[model samples]
Target chain A: MNWNQIRTVYGKEMRDALRDRRTLLSMLLVPALVIPGIMFAFTAVSLKVVKKAAEETPAVMIIGPGNSEPLQKALAGSPKLRLVPAASDYAQQISDKRIRAAVEIPPGFEADLAANSIATVKIYTYEGEMKSSFAAGEIDRILREFREAAVTRKLGERGLNASFVRPFEIKRQNVAPPEKVGGNLFGGFVPYLLIILSVVGAMYPAIDLTAGEKERGTMETILCSPVGRVELVLGKFLTVLTISLSTVVTSITSMALSAVGLVHLFAGKVGAGAKAVNAATGQQLPMVDPVGVLGVMVMVLPLAVVFSALLFSVSLFAKSHKEAQTYASPILFLTILPAMAAMLPGVELNAKLALIPVLNVSLIGKEMVSGSFRYDMMALIFGSSCLYGAAALAVAVRLFNRESVLFRT
Target chain B: MIEAEGLTKVFRDKKRVEVRAVDGVSFRVEPGQIYGLLGANGAGKTTTLRLLATLLKPTSGAATVAGFDVVRQAHEVRKQVGFLAASTALYGRLTARETITYFGRLNGLGDPEIAVRTRRLTEELDMGEFIDRRTDKFSTGMKQKVSIARTLIHDPAVMIFDEPTLGLDVLAARTIVRFIRDCRERGKTVIYSTHVMSEVEKLCDVIGIVHGGRIRAEGTLDALRARFGQRDMEEIFVAAVGGESALARQDVPPATTR
Candidate 1:
């Protein structure tokens, strides 16, 4: 096919799409707006909920008369947990609902502790609550610790040590790369967006160029031109791919930007031996290297094209603009199946997944997120998708030229 | 320059009955002449033109347009023919000049040649100023002029126009009639379809009246009038297409006439 003719058709359709303000806005502006908009809203709401939960939890009141000094110190050092000492107004405070929970200790608590007799601490709290239940559970936990310490001290007084009761403490330090750190957060839905976008992007131009042209009554005029049928179909198919690719790129960009934002939002809630930001300077601490993100972008491209072409082929089966839309709707769900399958947490990225479109992309994206670049699997995904895209594009063109498809009207 | 021999097309679906849109239709048109296919809506005038344009292939028989078979050499047929159906079928988003240039490119013309032809057509059609404006924003007459410019872009040897003057004002219709006349003057063959008898009388060198999948009459106006024993072409056309039943019955007392 002459590239000039293809360019002519492509230029005209692109101009047409641009002229349609609504369609143009739907394509570029929607993605630009929707991703950040949704992310911002969710972030604001999440922060609000967390802050509210912290605020609503009643302060922990320590009522131990003696031998519970260590327990009081632990509660005092926790910045997140508020510490309130038992007072004369404690009874009135409980009755007035001023406190969600309180721990009450008996007078001979220290004597019972030294004798090693069974000692119980009274804990008071409200019934049937949300965060208050966790608060109440925390109060009981401290009371249990105080009792254990008293028993340990009593054993010491009896000329024996509590070492036989327990072994040494256990500690684990995770040294995964920054990208992997982010992946551990979801390991679920983050990668699926790429697959969704490529399919959506591929579908828009196919339906618009084929069915849309028919609806506008321009297809007949186009067919009458001396332009070859193959050229016409290819021009339209390319437009759909371009649209789908742009969407995929935009979604990925949005995802990356959001990832950056989320990384900063969770600056303190992460591991060490890596530079953690103080949340003061917006400067990134280089948690995940730039190479990993680039790898993810490369990995997503092939899968994007494969699914995009699949959508293109399915859309070509439509006889009219309306029929094309109906033909395209079901394929949206089809993409979701692979997305769901790829979402099993702790699943490993492997070469066996290279044959699957959505699953392969998700795996590769996962690997990229974790700062692991598998060039071979990356090549397999991109090569297979490009091959699939070319095949799908050919089928779409053939369907377009078939007398049975375009001439049905 | 253009001919159809026993051309036929059958349309079918799973449940509905089959439709013979065109049946054994035959006709011929030499260069430097206007051949009018006159028929009512759905009378197969447009279908016959589409078949000749190679937009749709004939189910049987043969059509050779500009020395190219409409079936075996369909692309060649398209290369030589400029087809315009009743539908304006213009891309709403493209400017008139861009629309013409796009078709020129499709015809495989070089950029400079496309530019030259587009400029010449725009000036000849008296659409130079409006040509740069988006066609969707054009009036019916302006749009009709652009559509004409589109068909003329490839400079084909044969022009197939199906109801070219449809929904056109008097002035627009005049321009189209003049364009067809110009095509004939340039020795280009044209297969024109219209239901307007005056258009046929004034411009067509030959006329074919099609009805119910058949050509009811084909000849010069004089020949048709002589055959019907009527001087008026409209009266001949009325009598030719089984006549209008109401007018036919009203022309005589039913029982006595029977």
Candidate 2:
């Protein structure tokens, strides 16, 4: 293949692709704006919803209120859960969803507590109601605290230490640094989104260059030139590869920047909340490492080439733009399945899994972000993907040379 | 110079049934001459031209352009021949000058040579006014000019035109005819295909009447008129496709370049 001729084809296609409105929108504008915007908005919205849910005061009714004034006082003192008026039929109130939950304190509960006997307090809540569940949890916590207080008082009266009631204490710790922890947490989602966007960005230009050329009657003119079929296919392939790679790069960069900004914003609020417990905990959310970003970009390169070649070959079969779209849409689902495979729990990056295309990239991306490096698996992933890309490119060049495919009616 | 020896093409559909689109067709046109190929629709006129252009390979026989065999030296043959069709499609996003330069570079012309040729072809085709404008908004005639410029960008020794004026207006058709005459004046071999009888009569030095994928008559216009005892070219075409019954069944109206 002549390099000059290939460059000429590449240059012309780039000129055409750059001028296209839809391609510019999908490649530059969408990744630079839509992706980061959507991720940030989604994160912000979900965080706000969770905070609101935690802070909201949901009403609960106390049933059989004649015997437990101390229990009632304890319940009213809880900051998050509010005690409403005792309903005559509190079970009806819980079932009707008017109240989130109701607590039942039997008539002999104070005598039982004075005699140091076991007594049960029943909590009723509607199943599957979020606020109802929250209320139940709050009431359970208050009952536990009241029982603990009684135990401490009884122990002190008997001249025994409160420590005698405890057998052992359990403590948990995480050894991973912030970046690795962040990588492990958000790794699957980030790679999945990046692969999806890369494929999407490559689709329009692939169809435009191959099938679009045929529809426009320019394919004949180009084919009639002195350039070889391989050169033609490579020229178009590189053009598409550039677009797909740029898309992933821009999207990942913007998403990373926005995530950092969001982390800073949320850290302030969370740090204020953390001051009540431990002040340093809120600002420690992990980030994707710079090395991990570079590794992902490299690993995804072959996959992008695969998508570019596959779309080119498939679109070459189509006689028109609409038909090309029909031929190309199924590829999205085909790639989505493997890209999402990394999101599943217990799916590790073993040698066998590394041979898989999109799934391998995703799993390896997760590993890279988590600060795990298996050079053998990375090599296998990269080499196998290169083979796959070459194979697809061969098919594309073959299809391009076939007059039947090129001039199909 | 151009030559063909019983060039044929067979097409098979999904069912594997074969149809001979071009069957043992043969003709020749020397340098400085225009060979007009005449036929009714589906008489293999376009197929024959495509085979000669190396766009479609002949299932049997052989063709050569400027001494290069189409099958063995397709790239060389392509470098020496320029093919044009009636559609005259241009890249809508590319300006006329860019379109010409793109084809020139693809044809292996250097940058300076491509520039020089683009300028010359633009002037020759009368496309200087809209040379820098995108073709999406171009009229049919302006697009045809760009098409002609791109086709001749490499200064190929042979030209192949397949009903290039089929849907063109009179003014545009006249421009193409004049261009074909100029190509021959520059000592370029030309193979022109159309059902327009007057174009063949006025422009072609030699005429080949193709029917059912085979040449039924091969001679100059007067020679065909004398041999077939017919004065009108349409009647000559009717005879070549098997006389009046075939003429009665022609789907496309008889095209006259009057």
Residue-level lDDT of model 1, residues A1-409, one tens digit each, is 6788788788887777768775556567777778877877786686666557656646756676454555567566655456676786765676666665666666666566556576677676666654556577776666667657765876777787777555576655555654566655544355676667767766767677777776777877888777777777667666666777677677667757876786587555432212333243333333443565566556666666665556666655555668887888888887788777777776666777787767777777766665667788888888886787678667767776666566664
| Least accurate 10 contiguous residues by lDDT in model 1 chain A | A271-280
lDDT of model 2, residue B245:
75
lDDT for each residue of candidate 2 in B1-258, tens digit (9 for 90 to 100): 999998988887557667677888877899999999988777788888888878888899999899999999998998998889874478899999999999988888888999988888877777878999999999989988898998999999999999999999999999999999999999999999998999999999999997767788999989989988899998887876788776557543211111
Could you tell me the lDDT of residue A189 within candidate 1?
A: 54
Query: Which DockQ values do the candidates obtain, in the order shown?
Result: 0.38, 0.52
The estimated TM-scores of all candidates read 0.83, 0.93
Best of the candidates, TM-score: 2
Query: What are the chain A TM-scores for all the models, listed individually?
Result: 0.76, 0.89
Q: Kindly give the stretch of ten consecutive residues in candidate 2 chain A with the minimal lDDT sum.
A: A274-283
Segments in model 1 whose C-alpha atoms lie over 4 Å from true places: A55-130, A133-137, A186-190, A254-290, A307-323, A346-353, B14-16, B232-235, B243-258
Q: Once superposed on the true structure, which residue ranges of model 2 sit more than 4 Å away at CA?
A: A88-98, A106-108, A111-120, A124-134, A153-161, A261-267, A270-284, B247-258
